[model samples]
Target chain A: MSTVEHTDRGPLSREEMAAVVARDIPDGSYVNLGIGQPTTVAAHLRPGSGVVLHTENGMLGMGPVVTGDDADPDLTNAGKQPVSELPGASYFHHADSFAMMRGGHLDVCVLGAYQVSASGDLANWHTGAPDAIPAVGGAMDLATGAKDVLVMMTLFAKDGSPKLVPACTYPLTGVGCVSRVYTEVALFDVSGDDVVVLETWGESVAELVDRLQLRIARATRPRGPGRLR
Target chain B: MSRTQFHTAAGGTTAAEAADAALSASGVASGMTVLVGGFGMAGMPVALVDALIRHGADELTVVSNNAGNGDTGLAALLAAGRVRKVICSFPRQSDSWVFDGLYRAGRLELEVVPQGTLAERMRAAGAGIGGFFCPTGAGTLLAEGKETRVIDGREHVLEMPLRGDVALIGAHRADRAGNLVYRKTARNFGPVMATAAATTVVQVGGVVEVGALDPEAVVTPAIYVDHVVDLRSTSGEEHAA
Candidate 1:
């Protein structure tokens, strides 16, 4: 397979980016939506699709976010955000929840990324900042044990540095765990061969590279011999 | 001696010395009931647990919130088939094999309790409360065999205090006086079970001089703690498993 690069015209809206990422998810998949941008996927799941959501605090079959008047104070996600339960939902011991993650029972785990290496290494937990709390909190277990890992984040840090780099500097959650990447600039796949950019938001490859002010090598051809669509 | 006095004898040892001393003093004959504290993999008394397993204490009843994760924690005892009965709040899917196989074959006795009620039951025993009432499990399978009562037109299930012959706990630090403090999630269920057992043994990462712990931070008072065992300071080589 070869890397595929597409162009980006301008800054795409968050909804537009979410719609693109949501299209990759298949029906009837069990997924763990990591805190932050990945959590938005739950709000955009395809209707009538049997996507079973798993939370680490022992609730299965989670529904979309609950709005005002329907929210219960006791019902919350792992991050303590109020959530609704889907039909046929059940609660088990918290240990059972970790077991499912560690035993490779989850089909997909969509996680927010601080930095992802070319070889699919994930480093999202800690930044070694002096004020940051050092809690791993099941991220290592989910990253390593989940069947397929998807990273969702912006392409660059707030300081305008590339997050997809040659190697990660922070503590890695797992080695070679990330399979796909969804960024504000473009959607990319980190395969065994190279970083293949799938689609850009209306910008040419040369223009997008110039806009980001990075000298990244462009893919000569699309990976897998053709475009995904 | 009364069971309370029997605990005082066990509590006299330092945390590092508690494991071997408890093992030697208890005369823990095979096939006995053992209650340990810790939620999930945290707060497990690794040193004491290792001693029990090494001592080949078999056919035991283990009462805890969880049977640890695989390769560590209480699950090791279950993997060894040393546990005959598990009274816990939840079992992880990875460690479900032990519960599933033994429970299905009638070889293991499994009892599930509501998480909040289980914590309260332990706390009640520690506090000298004979029994407490709650509506958590009423009208469910958990109500079966449990005493039921109605007060003010509200149904409540009576859950008796749970006390064991031995209680194992984990601590972040302990003083020579037996005052204990747990770090983060490791604090779950440890302080409660400390008082609910005939003999309460604590495993601490560090054993400090008396008065080393702040007076305000001691979660489990020295009065209720009997023994303190120091965990082996391995270079990450010896873990819960």
Candidate 2:
């Protein structure tokens, strides 16, 4: 596979990046979207896909985020934000909810990350900064328990430093758990023997390889009908 | 005292008197591990916590998912300076100023557990299991102080039981016999906390006849529940529109 080119398009919007992630999810996959940006993927899910959403707090078949009277305090997502339920929604206690996450029952879980290692280690919980109050929530559980852990984040930090590196500088959330890295700039395949470049936005494979400073291998598997051209 | 106390306490005439009777019988003394239920305010037992605050128990160790939300349920308790330590997963949220201030000032002790491990530890406690090896938090900073084991060639961390002195939970409805039914996603920590506590107390929207709740759909069975405060009439203002 070679670099994906969308010459007609400008920079990817937030919705477009979410649409990219949504395109990869196979039909009838059981997915769990983490809080913040990854939660936006639920908005792009194709209807009748039979993709049940699992929230760590306690819910399956969660509906899209709602407002006004539709927002019930009683029905909320993992983030503790108000949400409604779909037709087949079900609720459980925290233990069982996390059991679904930690038991490898979920097909895929998309999470936001601070940094991800080339060897598939994830670091999203705490930065290990002495002053930062540590909060892990279900990050470790989702990272460990999902069948395939997919991280959604920007490719670089604000300082223009790469987040996808040889090893994570931050504290780890999971070791060798991530399968893919979905970034604003490109999509990476970290599950296999090689760190394959699945797709890229405006940059070439050489550009990413030079910037990331990690070993890059050509695609070992054939490409699918990707969202980009 | 006992689960039977709910039935025999003052003949259980009205909801208020019954709620008062349930709170008084909670045995919420000072220096106890209190497991408060809810994810944010979804299934928060506001009335029970309010009663506990009125019960005047100090130096409590609370086990919950979040430290507290706004200055209400658990936050109010923290703000009252009654809590000595907090064992929760996430304590820093937008409205968690009370916990933030306390944590920064070194007035409170905190143990940040992973959410899944937090729940499973209580589940293990309730199930009478000592501890189990878990895959969550295996290689993280959270697992540093804990014991580690390898099962199936993958690293796992040992998680121990976390039973409570008393559990405060919110449910949608309950039978007079205390078999509870929770509403929607509000059933977050109610079921596990109910079983993990030495004395489990619940606050439900209504108290139905013993046969009103479907036996098949009851989440927390009556045997695990010790007392249920029927907040049907009194909890309207607490859960406003």
Candidate 3:
């Protein structure tokens, strides 16, 4: 058996995309990182940044991942993955943890999305497949509760279809909740019905705008991958 | 069914039989709503849940954080076809074949709620709050037909409190008076669910003396807990083992 190799146009890696998102979180901010790709954001936060990490599974000030004997089976994140706790970490009931979220106490939430409408709607929890069991979890709560919602995903699907669309076809998690999107290929900020290109990877901004037929507002020219280095 | 074996609450402590007796006496009727506590397998009241399943209640509406994982625990209850609808946050995970099969076959119904909202609704029910405003599902289908309000310049949606006929929960320890203390994250929904149900039965790892537990450490005070089962006893060990 042989594995096929392929190449695509992109500069920032997934880690770089996470770093790009992490750089925007201000000091003293309370943030929630959604499961899956968004969990990577914690590894890239600058030291002593003072960003408090909140997990929907009733924990605040969560530390990095714990492995081997150090892992506590009961001490886990919303994803049920074992994790450590930083100093001053506190635990609460599930209801109280949500009270923090729905009360708008979180400054930012970075999430993984399946589709994001140009108008900032999110469709990440379900694909509407007939056989698929939808897991909505805390996505809807984070979508609406966080002051600023940043979505992290690839620019397109594995099938080469654009995830950024005129309107989300899947069942939406929340409407007009997403403010910024960090993709493998580009960074865009979503307004009411327009997408502003903040940066593009290897692909030219004009090319992406033309290919996707995006109504683009270019705030600045695309930078090379070496710029981050 | 076994009225002779049942005993009502006197003081804070009820008969141990109440855990099973209350549920059994509730008649195991169809279309009943039950609140169960656990996140994965962390803090589930296994003995109480097993008793409920053995009682063979059908057409139940179970509210929990996750649909049972693997083939044991809540999954066993679900596999027995005792549930009609499940109100949960994450209804499906890698090992949730029972719910998936039943749902796909149209034998089951699901109401998927966000985790925070689910917790808050139960909290509201227990705290005696009529209803509260939340922004969690405001612009989504979950917000459809629900009242909307603008608070602090942001759109918020109304979510009503949720209550259950019975609550099955777990705790690390409990006093003779039923003051409950939980171990770490296992305490997920137990405290809130204890307050939201008409009859709350707790399965504790151990049952200590009346003054054994520290008052400050008690998460669910004796006032909220109706019945207690000590799962750490030799009999409980045999049942679980």
**Of the candidates shown, which would achieve the greatest TM-score relative to the real structure?**
2
After superposition, the stretches of candidate 2 with alpha carbons farther than 4 Å from their true spots are A1-10, A223-229, B1-4, B7-20, B234-241
TM-score of model number 3? 0.87
Top DockQ hit: 2
Which of the numbered candidates is closest to the native, going by highest lDDT?
Answer: 2
Candidate 2 global CA lDDT score:
0.84
Evaluation by TM-score, superior candidate among 2 and 3: 2
Instruction: Write candidate 2's Cα lDDT for A82-168 as tens digits.
Output: 887888888888899888888888999999999988889999989888889989888988999999888889998999999998899
Model 3, range A40-149, lDDT digits (tens) per residue? Answer: 99998889989999998788889988889998876888788888889999888898887788778989999999899899999998888878887889899888888899
Q: In CAPRI terms, where does candidate 1 land?
A: incorrect
DockQ of each: 0.02, 0.86, 0.62
Backbone clashes counted, model 2? 0
lDDT of 3: 0.80
Q: Candidate 2 on B1-241: residue-level lDDT in tens?
A: 2253442212335554555567778888999999999888888887777777777889999999999988898999999999999999999899999999999999999999999999999999999999999999888888888899899999989889999989988888778777889888888889999999999888776667778988999998888888877655532333310
Per-residue lDDT tens digits for candidate 1, residues A1-229, read 4434443256557776666666777788888888777888776778887888987655678777777998653456655466887888765433446557756788888898889888888887667675432344456657765778888888889898889877888867666778887787776677555665665655665665665533444545434322222
